[model samples]
Target: MADEKERRHQHFLVVAYGAQSHVNPARVLAHRLARLGGADDGSILATLSVAVAAYCNMFPSLDATTDGVISYVPYSDGVDDVSLPRDIADRARRRRASSESLSGIVASFADRGQPVTCIMCTMVSPPVLDVAREHNIPLAIYWIQPATLLAIAYHYFHGYNELITSHANDPEYEVCLPGLTRPLQIRNFPSFFIDVSGTERAKAFIEVFQELFEYMDLWRPKVLVNTFEELEPNVLAEMKQHLDVFTVGPMVRSPMETQIHLFTHDNIDKESYMEWLRAHPDESVVYVSFGSLVKFSKHQIDEIVGGLRQCGRPYLLVLRRDGIEDDQSHSLVENTQSQGMVVDWCDQLEVLSHSAVGCFVSHCGWNSTIESVVSGVPIIGVPLMFDQPTNIYLAEKEWEVGIKVERNSDGVLTGKELARCIELVMGEGAEAKVIRERANVLKEIVQATSDTGGSAERSLRDFVKTIQES
Candidate 1:
């Protein structure tokens, strides 16, 4: 039993950044750590919730009793005025205002005599890096996105001879990366990267990617991606050649063939919505959602609505109408009234896992992209910002899992184009089946890698051991 006692002494300070997307994975890892060896074993698990309190809500999933392995520490938003883009300048002020709130986290860990030995942090949160440096802890930087995208980001920052210089305007131009099987277009990069040519936004975007790449060198955190080796062998292989790479995800549980229905919702009594989905019998239903955070202007939103109306196939859309003003705004709803369900948020995992969902219209965030692929749901990539466009390119071109959408100069997505894309994804001649079958194979590999003796589980166990020693 002395051995058990020794094991229980292993502790970690799992640090997380803002948003549910970033926090969820860390929580999953924490749960895995807490359950080490067995259910009754109480391993010393503690957390320093850094950067933003947005993650505080996810603490319940990690520790139901609220006493296990958790503490919230507010951090100074290190972004200065010089770093702010026109669109995000206000956000900088907010971060600066709350910078001091993170001081308590440092105090708590110091008081406990647990000088955090290892820091696990999501990418983009500078505060975690700051604290990890201050404490001299070996940090594990979680990418929370695909390795392919990270490679692209790295390549972009390194100025790799214009990966898509002339082809930026050509949709048909196949982009050939060092490890990818096929070429992708510059448009396949996230929308922000594609459109921001010489604008202030472009410079800011460059800065963010530069920061990410610099973090890669100076910090040298063990790189963690939300993918398995089988799905992205070429990209993963290329990445490992450069860094201390580790894979611990696709992060969600693998539903077996019989259990695929485990995540599907039958109680979605939005009968009207389901009825619309049923109207397109034998035809695949395209699922369009932009996730929770991104917002579209009224014109952009209406254009999307019109496009769906024109696409003429059945669609399930989750549209958050927040901040969209118009007493007459119901006019937008009335336009595409027949073909879609525009909810604020849907059970995305459950919806993706459903048998009926054929294609996803996504922002290409890692979590959503991984979930879509794992569920064998093809996608229509419409990236907003950050790693999303990179993810979209990988999904549509490299992974052969889906297609892409085009946006106009005014940033308006036309209804006719939307309709055409939807039809191409779900129509009779569509490669929807091929996409689904390929995705299933990817899912199988991820499940195998995340199981009891799989790479992710083992790597996580090793990490836990390191935490214990620290």
Candidate 2:
């Protein structure tokens, strides 16, 4: 068995971005790749994962979670704990160390009989790609963002900078970009593109995307995006013109497979939450989460409390500390008298799968978006930053799975407005019915695309074939 394995694909390394959001998808993809090694074909691929130290500390489960499918490795990035103060200097050190550590990984793997053949790095780790190129190891990028964001990045770096920038201030102003069917409002554009001079981190993401584009220009490599073909056909088609793009995702667990989580479950009566849903009528509860980041302001938290009270719905909200000083949201959650429960975190996918979950109040993170889509839950988008706005646009404008609530003149989403949006989605109205039906339809489509021998599976097979050929 060892000799046969040695004769085949040998090894494929998946480097994770370490954050819960990034690592979760990367690990799922790695699992698929590992499983592919056992296919009837006379090929084998040993999968290994490398995560940055910072997220490693946050999610120690990665160290013990693999069930002999993939090997987990950690690379130090100056600050092992993300809670530590990090700046440009720390980032530079992390990048340099990551590259060197990868070099060591390559040598170590080569020393073993199974040599590393390909490296698939999750988004935000260009240094991993550089190491792969330097080592002459074939590599692909696993883009976790939606194809719409990819299109936005492509156009932003290509030529549409002036048009996008001009409308940055006009939150209601809409702009048409290539590949997308609907016009994107200024509010729909990613905050970084609108606020180019916004923050150091935002600027850093621009630089990263710019560098990634440059690398792609140098070598138009394959990019494995975390979306199915049906979800974003136009954007995927247009992106394919530039590089070999494959839709190898909705890289998520099936409903039959137990839900995957990187963080510890908030020690709530986990079963009781599901039981609460079972007690409620179908499509009668609300699910809310901001996806591992973004602390809600006290004002925002208060508004949420108000909305839940006004809507008078059974709701589950994931309220984490998120390493911020602001305790108003947490405190208010503790004290608020709403007919709902708040967990620091919960089995989000499982909660979404519950028949009682009527609509999702989401931050529009890609993972949450896809999960909601798969679960057939309609959404109410409250996007904050990064790729969220674009996701909300897709949800509200493109897919019709959700609506984005309007902020007041003070730019606050008051309780009344929040209640209004929730009612709009969850109420027994024509629009709400339409959204639910569309969400259900999309859910079937997503499941079909993710089923065995489906779009996502075929894409993975093709990716494996590419590695074999290489």
Candidate 3:
């Protein structure tokens, strides 16, 4: 039996979208799969596949291929540019190119005598499903969003589409989604659902998800969500009735674990930010970051700086180089030098785990949300789009560890509102204390789940066993 198992080595291929948010979780999942080994000792292997542009960004020096565990493979998405597509035509080209390129990658793998046993893909493209089917490889969707979002998307397509679409413009309108305990406001839903912009780009975005859900219904592949059972038991349970759902995450990098950055951390002294963080007292600094993709308007930047200054606490603000103009960036840096340190980017998990950092002012991206929960840092959510609004909903309402800052009628979060939320989260009041305590408790739960033999680990192991047996 051992010899038989050893002879049938299993190779897993993970394909991810080129964006930083998508790539990070996919990378973490690939590493976890590699660590699990195979049915027989030393017989398992995992490879990470991303778009060529993103691959280049991650390995800027073009120095190494394998990250010592999982091997790296790049698939052409038609465009070799790092920036995401701005129009529908480019998106279509990417999908077609990705399909052809990825199919070739699989064929080449077989030629090399290491055919993939399973393929896992994040929301990259529908072509991934076709590729897995053509190769007869078991495939799983690596859902890097909250399971709540999955449940919502499921219900939205299942039977609630009309109800949601009719009330799309009504932000305050509430609907009790199946399996969700409370009624969610239209505003709390994913931005994709409410986008009535009528632009081809927005329509294309909607069409992609629509097709994805349609595939889920048709193929019924396993969904490996990046959320723990404890964090979203209800939604997970609901999903299991129709889909093979696995709670295998909080797939966040630990403070000690090295992270792969898909974006360049340039024009900033990384050490200087860490040194400044060390200088502050415990729970005294506010850390502000909006992940890699969200480009804020100049007014929004000024509002954020105003809020941070008014909060009267030391802050470490990450303003990405591409997100702001040079002149504006320099002016904001000089203005906030007395009260905070502004950098292009820094090691987020390190900052979150630091003693001096108390609250995170975030755009509530799912990756950032899970990181905050793992690090025991509370959030002041200022969600923009995609799944961010849903993630914030989970944080503020479901988890009770954060608060959402309200934007004005013009859809702008003013400095006053930002400052108010910051104080509410970081103040010495009882509500703030409760939020802090809840965050710590949830952090412990997340850690336990990710530990050896915990629910997440067990789920991942089960997934490996299932794929190997198949």
Candidate 4:
């Protein structure tokens, strides 16, 4: 009872922008703080109230415990209706409503004696940063993307498009950046920013990237990235020179690390998937998943199906409908006829860690990339957009641990190429054995990071100290 009373008196506030990547970590931190019981009025303001509410509904056990200490403030209502590609534009359009909600939440927190001390802004949500500044609080931005991607974004802001453009034409062009000695080209850079589509809306969106880079320069907030130093040593070192960086990542260590209460259905058959994998000989099953957000067209989906079919090895696929535009194409699963068990979603960590799973075919989302690395699984990289290409580049080029697939005009990966790509990773291709060995080494390092005295533990401790000191 005395402990509860003491916990009730200590407080801290975290504002997460409307994304699961941001909310998950914030939720974990909130729970960690609550378990410590330092303050009662600690508030967690989130932009994804609907998502969080849905998560709470799905996983009551985890969320219900800390509800008393953490307050979820929905900064924008109905924001999920907006398409992800146009998220910033939508936020800009509703700036007034957004600002009002944010200010109100901070003011409310103040009224309760829980002065907002630290705000963790995700991606380019400047409003959260603005509110933190208004309240005189220390703000830290978390990047789910690799540092190399951030550097590319910075390059784009500075009008250095030559490296990206040149690289796309010739993968060996070796375009140079401030910190990198080797010239990188377009084939390796993020494909999304290649050509401005000349739409007014697109042009407006382009400005946001520049605005984000400029904002970072002006604010210079300490950054805590969900990436590991070992994965992108060059990029991490360069980024650290610019601002304070702490690389304690692969945040999705497991279901427990996610901190959100997920429904059992969301993870059901996870063990079954592992059991199936174990039945196979070692390093046989290939796991395929295109991270959470990317959508694909029908032609591309057909190609992907063809490629997987060609592999002829047991495979586990996490399928989503976002990729196929046509209803028919979206039904590729029906035609594939269960050659590979196509699930909508599963516990990724369990599947990757399964003994039967040998390789990962991924969109190279940082979370997925790191998870695959930690699991000692090599990757077949098919990056889609944003930081994905950069993530793929680091996985393949920097780490020498993956194979890249070529994308067609419509950004569809054909079945033939997909099959070949899988074989290249699994077969005795060039550098295949060497890459596998390196991947195993990386896996060990990631395990150590999560263990005692590793970078992740140290970073989390530093995070706690920042809050306590503040």
- Best candidate per TM-score, number? 3
Can you write out model 1's per-residue Cα lDDT over 1-470, one digit (the tens) per residue?
A: 97676546655566665565776566566555655656555455556464433433333233333434344443545542223335556555544443344435555665876445466777665555555665566777777777777677666656653655545566566666676666656656655445548777766556655666687787667777777777778888888887777777777643321111111223453445555555665336778878656767777777777787777656777765553554356456744555576655555676676666778888888878888877777788887776787787778766778888887777667777777777777666647666666777776776677678888888767656654554
> Which window of ten consecutive residues has the lowest lDDT sum in model 1?
256-265
Estimate every model's Cα lDDT from 0 to 1: 0.64, 0.78, 0.86, 0.66
Error of 2 at 143 (Å): 1.0
Stretches of model 3 off by over 4 angstroms after superposition: 1-8, 38-40, 83-90, 266-268
Ranking by TM-score: 3, 2, 4, 1
Candidate 3 lDDT tens digits, 1-470: 96786555878899998888988899889888888884336478889998888888888876667977789998987878876777877777777888899999999989998888888899637779778877888888898998898888888888998898889999999999878988999999998888887987668777888888888888787889999988988878888998988888989876777878876664257578888988899999999999887777778788888889888988999888787744464476654666798887788888899999999999999999999999999999989889999999899888999999999989888999999999999999998999999999999998789888888889998888877777
Residue 176 local lDDT, model 3? 91
State residue 396's C-alpha deviation in candidate 1, in Å: 1.8
TM accuracy, model 4: 0.82
Question: Across residues 1-470, which tens digit of lDDT does each residue of candidate 4 receive?
Answer: 86564433434455564444456655644554454443534332222222334444434553432355455545553343334435555656565555566777778767965656566665666566566667776777667667777767767666686546444546556567766546666656665566555665556556656666776788777677777777677877887777667775756545444434332334356666666677788888889988666667776676777788888987888776544467676566754554577766677777787778889999887767877888889999888766677777788878888878887766668887888878878888667787789899988888887665677767755765665555
Q: Return the top candidate by lDDT.
A: 3
Q: After superposition, how far is residue 93 of candidate 1 from its true place, in Å?
A: 8.3
What TM-score goes with each of the models? 0.78, 0.92, 0.95, 0.82
Name the runs in model 1 displaced over 4 angstroms.
Answer: 1-8, 44-103, 110-115, 157-177, 182-184, 190-205, 208-212, 253-284, 310-313, 323-327, 334-339, 408-411, 465-470
Give a tens-digit lDDT track for model 2, residues 392-412: 889888899999988888877
Model 4 spans > 4 angstroms off? 1-13, 17-73, 77-80, 83-91, 158-174, 255-275, 335-338, 408-411, 428-430, 463-470
